[model samples]
Target: MRLSVAVCVPLALANWLLFSLSTMWADLEPRDLQFQSPLAWLALWANLLGIALLLAVLWRFGLEILEALAAAIKQLFAREVDWPAWFAELYAGLRPLPLFTLPAAALWGAWLVLFYFFDHPGGYATDVAFQIAAHALGACVYLPIFYRWRVLTKASSHDPQISG
Candidate 1:
């Protein structure tokens, strides 16, 4: 789906940018650094929210791909004269879901927390590891939710009476 490609590519780039910057910052900072308070908790919540938003987009992207495949099959079976036109129509119908902000916010938040939240001399590695583990957990939690949303969206799209 164009929408997915458009949104995800930029997000991936941004993530890389932030990750690099964070690594640089971490390297430059004094070895002895830690958050004055429990800023990791804020990072945790932001990461969770980002995961939720990305899962929603991923669900929509999967559904759009499935719909396009189905449409292509139907068109092929019918021997449609203008397949490109049909595809263009389908692409147009695949409206972009509104979730461009979540990934950015999440990445920035996580970067800040990871690169800025260490006080002890030997805590940086542990904190970074914790961030990684938290993101992994978030992904695990989001998978099922994405699947459920995809199924629901597919069902609702099929029923013509359901509007918006």
Candidate 2:
């Protein structure tokens, strides 16, 4: 699980960088130039490969990764933790979709509004900063719901009769 996260995060960041570069190039380059550029093609393929790998890791080992993260976070604030009881209480009556979607929508809406009001033609650093900020915002919106869903899935998997 730790290995999966260590690999997945770097791949995710690389994908983001490639995606940002490709989009920025598209905006800045002529159509002919874009079509003829090897760097553009390389970036595209790299981004796709990174995405595929990241998704594969997440699909296979995501539950364990989230569980590990949850455990670590729990350890931070408490000396003694009851794993079963904590998870039971945490996931009790949980509805992940609304929890994820509502906050995500609100956050994205606010981000868009901020971009509209504050966007300017800046250099690479500024664009990268904006991209990082956007990804961080998305992470904030998705991580908790993802953790919840993963824990629920893990719990359900342990009991054959139960379904999530």
The candidate that wins on TM-score is 2
In candidate 1, position 5 carries an lDDT of 44
TM-score of 1: 0.26
Clashes of each: 4, 0
Candidate 2 — worst ten consecutive residues by lDDT sum? 93-102
lDDT (10s digit) by residue, model 2, range 1-164: 34424434544555465445556455564544454467867766777776778677776886667567766765664324356744554445232433444444454444444443355345566557666765775575456655664565566557644442
lDDT (C-alpha, whole model) for all candidates: 0.50, 0.54
Cα lDDT of candidate 2 equals 0.54
Which ranges in model 1 have alpha carbons more than 4 Å from their true place?
2-30, 52-56, 59-88, 92-164
Please give the RMSD to the true structure for each candidate, in Å: 13.4, 10.2
lDDT of 1 by residue, 1-164 (tens): 44534455555555544554454345555664443335654564466567557656765676675566746654554332244433443444443232433453455456545554443334667667656765764564345434444443454456543323
Model 1 — which ten-residue stretch has the worst lDDT? 92-101
